[model samples]
Target chain A: MIQLEKIEKTYTAGTVQTPVLKGISFSIHAGEYVAIMGASGTGKSTLMHILGCLDKPTGGRYRLDDIDMVNLDDEALSHLRNGKIGFVFQQFHLLDRATALRNVMLPLIYAKEYPADAHQRAEKALTAVGLAERMSYKPNQLSGGQQQRVAIARALITDPAILLADEPTGNLDSKSGTEVMAIFQRLHRDGRTIILVTHDRNVADHARRVIVLKDGQVAEDRLVAQPRDAESELAAVVDEEVRP
Target chain B: MRTLRIAQEGARALAAHKLRTFFMMAGTIVGIAALTVIMAVGKGTEKKVMKRVNAFGTHAIMITAGGGKGFSPPQAGITTLRLEDAEAIRSQVQGIDVVAPFAVRRDSSTKAGSNQLQTIVMAVGADWHDAWEWYTTDGEPITAEDNSTMARVCLLGTLSASDLFGSQNAIGEDIQIGNVRFKVKGILEPRGTSPMGDEFDRRIVIPLTTGMRRVFNQDYITNIRVTVKDSRQIESIAKEIRQLLHERHHITPPRDDDFAIFSAADIAKMARGISGTLTYLLIALAGLSLLVGGIVLMNILLISVGERTKEIGLRRALGATQGDVFHQFLVESLSVTILGMVAGSVLGWVVSITLARLTQSPVVISWESFALAIGFALVVGVFFGVQPARRAAKLRPVDALR
Candidate 1:
């Protein structure tokens, strides 16, 4: 569970202070699949950063599992991020030198009480993402879609309570994007909380609930009457846009 | 677990950029190697000089003719010192043991078999062996009868004997010096070199009477070497001898006595001065190289930190604390430095050994020198590594990710 009360974020350059997120408030319940839709400068990425504990809110209280996060230092915030949240970026920032399996095992390195079966857990995460056969491959060897899958697997290896994705399918073709959306839908069905930030309407439609941001504030927050199923959409696949 | 992972990640990162890592470590390697060599050579030269000082017995003192400032060694035909002055120093000066007067001729070419070489022909008295603390390795030293009769018997230096005889026994063999053929009565032990860089093994010794009568035909001996009854009394004994020499020669200050007395410490001090300056010069050069090496390491590490901004962001995003990032870079730098120290130690020893062999000098590398070089290298690693590591650690995850 996550909660934020009038979170304010501002960027200053010399004498001028420009507001990016102006008194925005929201909450996402546990095991919910939520999509945040916004254009450039709407501060969706900044909100995602605050939600993932990668950064602190400029002015407001942020609570995750009933613990206040605003006053936490960088080290304590890092521990919170390590244990409670997993992140996936558009660029799929998998280490180029490491194998997918090693990338998946990376989060465990920061875990305070590391699991004895870290390799097996990482392997299971990779298997869940349909990358079991390609775990030994490096990020460069993988397609954009496969690299994103590896990132997801790495994010999932920590068994985090919240999965935060910032435009997960931005770099992939429609076919690979559909495949990634199917995995996200399956994770949601398995009772995992997923928060996806995207500009694409079709990508936002894959989630059950959507929150559209306009001018640094939430314009609309509503649940879909009938959410689009990624698996059913993927079944009508076309072959022309294969990843090159 | 975290520490191990950080170390592994650092190693992987270094291995990814092999050329940069090698260049970074080259400075430390060469720096430490140069330091090792300088330390070895300094100690070795000191030992060699001390051995030379010991060759001239610590209990002995010499009064030489015609020198200013430093002690002037006795050379052939100085004429300022006489045999009577030596007898007076022996009888009148308390703590005096024995006085051996030396009459010398240099550049006396000698031939034995096919070997011909330039050597000094010094005529010394029967007290030479006792006053110099020297004796023959084979056969007998010059006797009182040999000095009294002015016999044509001589002692061959070890190196000169080897040069002429070539493994053949030198005793009883005749060696031709100029037109005279003197029979070798004994061979002196190898004494190597003097502190003044003079080769001790290239000379032959004959009786003082033979040198006065036949060799140079000079009535005056060149120098007098005297041994003291107590080694500790040389300073007082030297003072007494100086007064006696000035009185006997009938010379006063500002009139220039034309003779100088040198205790064993004087020669040792002079030798130490030469070696000390040389050691300081070598160490300065070594230190400069290490400084240059450290600068190179710092610059390259800074560049490396700048280039790895994205990797740093990714690690931070993966829940790495700033301390983790700092520790990672530091470990990377220290790893290379430690590796260089190990490699440099072996490489430096090899280089120093080869250099010593070429220069025909001993090379002494003490354990403390090795330890000091390694300790200095570790300090350099930490000193140069901290700045880059701190810079990397201070990078914000959001900014670095961009």
Candidate 2:
């Protein structure tokens, strides 16, 4: 579960004042699948960064599982990011020198636990992403979709409470994107909390609830009438686009 | 497990840039080598000088008689030091081992079928051989009976025997000295050259009574050679001998004492001082070279840090702590220095042996010098490595990742 009240983020770029996030508030409960949608410069990515504890809010309070995030030091924040939340980036930031298995073992390395079972758990995570045979392949050796799968496996290796994916399918083709969305839908079905960020309406539509941002403010927060399977929903959207 | 993983990652990163790592290491290796060579040269030269000093003989004293003052025409006086004075020193000095009196005169040229050489003939008493630690190569030395009877026998130095007899047996052969014939009773061994480059094995020796009665007809000796029991007591023993000579001469207040005593220990001390100075100079030169090597190491390491900035950033983003980054760079620097130390040690030994052979000087490779050189090189590595490591550690992970 995550909660934020009147969060603001301002960055100073050499004497000029830039406000990326201004007075934004939101909440998400456990086991809920939510997608945040916004146009460029609407602070969705900034909000997601704050929610993932990669960056802190300039003003206001954030609570994750009743623990205040703003009061934690940098090391403690990193610990929270490692132990409680798993992150998947749009660019699939897997370490280039490491194999998929090694990449997935990174969180456990930082947490300093499950050292003996790290390899086994990493293998299991890769298998869950349908990448068991490609565990020895480096990031550069894998396809774009396979690299994203490796990144997702790395995020899920720690079995964190919430999986925060920032535009996870943005770099993949439609078919590979559909497969990634199907994995996310399956994880949601397995009762894992998922917060995804995207500008694509079809990707947002696959979530149980969609929160849209306009001009640094939430424009809509509503549950979908019916949640379709990610593959069929993607096909339906493609069909509608062809008709138009 | 975490530490092992971090170390493995560090090694992998270093392996990725082999050329840079080698270049950085070159600085340390060359520096250590220079230090090793310098230390070897210093120690080798010191040993050579000490050996030369020791060859002059320890705990011995030389008393030369000449140049007295307070006379109307500078008093070209014959200060005839008698056998009585030598006996007085032997009886009165507490640490006296042996006292031998001798007189020298340039006698004559000896010829053997066309080749002739001028030689100094020295007449020595019975204790002279033991006092000077002389050894014979052929025949036998003059005995106490020969000295007392003033026998007309002489010992030819190695060069004298070779020149007169052309490597043939020279014992019992006759040679002309100032129109006087003296038989060669023994041949002296080759004693090598002195510091003044004089061939000591070129002279001739005879009984003191023979030189006084048959050759020079002089009744007194020119010098007295005194051997002491121990080198540590030479200063006091020399003083005792001086006092005894003053009493025998009956000189009041002993102004100049009519003689100058030279202690072999003093000469050894002087030689040691010179050796110390030379060693210091060599160490300084080596230090300068090491300093240059250190600067080279620092320059290369700084350049490496700049070149590997992106790799450093990547490692940091991969969860490397600041201390990890610091240690990684430090290890690279240390490896360079250690390699240089090994190479330098070998190089120093080679150089020392070559110098010893070429100059015919003793080369002493001291373990202390080797350890000091290697230790100095390690210090240089740490001294030059810390700056770059700190700079790398202070780089922010986010900025580096970006």
Q: Which candidate number maximizes lDDT?
A: 1
Runs of candidate 1 with Cα error greater than 4 angstroms are A238-244, B58-60, B66-75, B87-131, B135-219, B226-282
Q: Write the per-residue lDDT of candidate 2 for residues B103-218, one digit (tens) a residue.
A: 87653565655658787677898788898898787798989999878787889889888877887888877877666777888888787765335567788888898888887776
**Residue ranges of candidate 2 with Cα displaced over 4 Å:** A1-6, A12-19, A23-37, A40-54, A62-69, A75-87, A90-114, A117-143, A156-244, B58-318, B343-366
| Chain B TM-score for all candidates, comma-separated | 0.74, 0.78
Docking class of 2: incorrect
Which pairs of residues clash in candidate 1, taking residues 3 or more apart in a chain or in different chains?
Answer: none
Name the fnat for model 2: 0.10
Query: What would the per-residue lDDT of candidate 1 be over residues B95-175, giving only the tens digit for each residue?
Result: 788898887677888998779978888889999989888889999999999999999999998888988888899999998
TM-score result, candidate 2: 0.69
